[model samples]
Target: MSQSASDQSDRTSPVKTQSPLILDSLPDIPGVEDCSLRVQQKIDLILLAIEALELGGSEYMLATAKELELQSIVDNRVALWRMRCSNPWRRSHVRTRLTLKQGKALTLIASYRARQLTVLIRQLLVAQQQIQEKGLPLEQHFRLSDYLERFRAHFRSRMNPRRAKVAVYLADENQLNDLALSLLSQLLFCTGTYGLKRLWVSLFDGEVA
Candidate 1:
């Protein structure tokens, strides 16, 4: 059988095999325990975007957590759901707080997955760039189109549209697409050498003094 684009890209990429990411030795950020709501939302959204890109994303998160011995933080599927539901925009919003430990677990899982999907992420971003330079609609790129479509569907179904913030995205497709693209960019960043640390610190952007 012919290799798929993602497969071909992965084969051609220069990533070297490495050990799993372990956060046990790293000291927790000072303000991570007091993470703001926006930080929680951003972290969940980035994971959600990954779910949109890859099939069985939820399962993969669970598997990756166990592989990295982070199951203590991520635990079962319900635990993961509740963590993600901490996002204010979730239709099933729970007023729970995400601790620094839990946040780091999810961050590690996301970063690991991002590294695995680096080739595909780069391809999609490049496709978006080329399409825009040619003044072509995003749908002109099949893989990117599929990813954006899945992202929009996931967002519409999971988010509370009645919420003023989510309502704005519902009202404007372009804004939503831009958000999807932005998340794609962030995932690309997570594929970098210092991506894990960078993303972790970024979660505390404004919340930290």
Candidate 2:
């Protein structure tokens, strides 16, 4: 066999192996507890979609999104109408239908969001693992707490600085006029307790002291 033929045979061999990328350690955010179970299913779905995209290109994602939207709309409408029924037996039937519809909608939305989040986390994990494997430079990692603190700080700075005082009063006039001096004593006690900053009074056929 010619040297060139041998080289071509080697290049076209079916048993060629590439090194698989392995992740070392994943992020340890507090909310990421049970991370393996929570993220594995998502990661699997995402990887499948990514493989599909590699095979079918952008058309596959668009088609899938469109199909998902159609299903979502149908499910939403069914759930809404089902909840509107009044009869007990019919309501029960409708409620079951609504639950199923909502479940389907939630599953689709959760699956899609999970796929996106998994892709992001996988990218970070791969990059970090690669750095560790190569003994290369390290990048700063942000945890959930750090992100939340920054958010809170930004929100606090943007809020209004002034504070206002408010007071509420409930009064009954019927008891006040009938008991005369007894009502006056009650009014004085209440006024002191309520921190009356100023006093104003009006009297009919009478003079103020």
Candidate 3:
């Protein structure tokens, strides 16, 4: 039996369908608790990015303003968007996304997270510099936190530890420590962690295969 032209058209014609671009998203990270507090979380992430990039005072405010096309950061601060508001603006917002008593939280967390990451990064970069220049002095003799703290105190004046925030980002990416641990604790995690302890325990047990 010959099929009708209608049948042929129905079978051969491409299905007209479209997938709307999926721009709006909140990373469904397992342990992070998103609630009324999520706005603060987003702001905190942005502040870390700002601090890591060394965007200071007006520069920080201006970057957010320009990226979001707001007249000023005061505007940005008020018209909060969804998605993690972070730097390198491309990664900050979703296409169409949507806050809480978020106003107060945003202000507070922004300053707090920025200062926190700044110090953490300054510490990490100091550690990295020491490793490269002198080849890991005192690492074998001291736990990482104790050593890094002493190193920071050794410097007479504040070094502009403004550098890429790889250290902070690395801690998050690595699933290291836990949320309970402070960011500094996460950074200075070369010793005193379960993972490090396990590694040390295995040191003499097996020969190189």
Candidate 4:
């Protein structure tokens, strides 16, 4: 080939390279990304509480408020993260502390951000009751279908297109439910861009599911 033609060919040629497929592959570490830490911590605490209940029963679990406190701590962290990452300094400066009375009143609000944890707490109490009556397995994996239904119900009840958007996070298994996932996708889109949008769901492994 002529020198000019060879030079032109080289310029037009596509280059092949290999590097770590960080985006394609899930991150090994959990809670490495923004917003994930709070979710992971809450889930872990819920599971731990479940284990404690199975071992000791209701009286034992309620006697200690460690799980509840841990959940609160994670909730505070989520608030802090949102303030730092998204909101302006002026707006973020607003007080987020919860007084005893205020905390009691805001339990429902807390459930919005920590739905899984809240549900787990209720389930633990029920399981404790059941165990007292009849023994049962302690480690229970929540049904994906039930979880999704609860999420959708929560969205339908609280979602305000003018005010806030609904965010749904799905695990890998949940994502495989194409019909449900698509419905959620449509709901999010209809919620609009100006108001709150659904936060993209992440996998248990900290990958985008």
Off by over 4 Å in 1: 1-21
List, in order, the clash count of every candidate structure.
0, 0, 0, 3
lDDT of each model, Cα atoms only?
0.84, 0.29, 0.33, 0.31
TM-score against native, each model: 0.87, 0.22, 0.25, 0.20
Per-residue error (Å), model 1, residue 88 = 0.6
Ranking by lDDT: 1, 3, 4, 2
Position 167, candidate 3: lDDT? 38
Model 3 earns a TM-score of 0.25
Show where candidate 3 strays beyond 4 Å. 1-35, 38-42, 45-49, 52-58, 70-209
lDDT-superior candidate, 2 or 4: 4
Model 4 TM-score? 0.20
Candidate 1 versus truth, CA RMSD in Å, comes to 10.7
Give the poorly placed runs of model 2, Cα more than 4 Å off: 1-67, 71-98, 124-209
| Higher-ranked by TM-score: 1 or 4 | 1
Candidate that would win on TM-score:
1
lDDT of 3 by residue, 1-209 (tens): 11243234435662222111111111222332222223334344333333333435335554544442323113354344332332122234343322211232233334333443455555554654576587755343233444334323321121222323423433352222222124333333323323223222232233223
What's the CA error at residue 45 for candidate 2, in Å? 19
lDDT value for candidate 2?
Answer: 0.29
lDDT of 2 by residue, 44-144 (tens): 22222232223332233334434555232222433333432211222122222222222222223324433434444354445545665888643343432
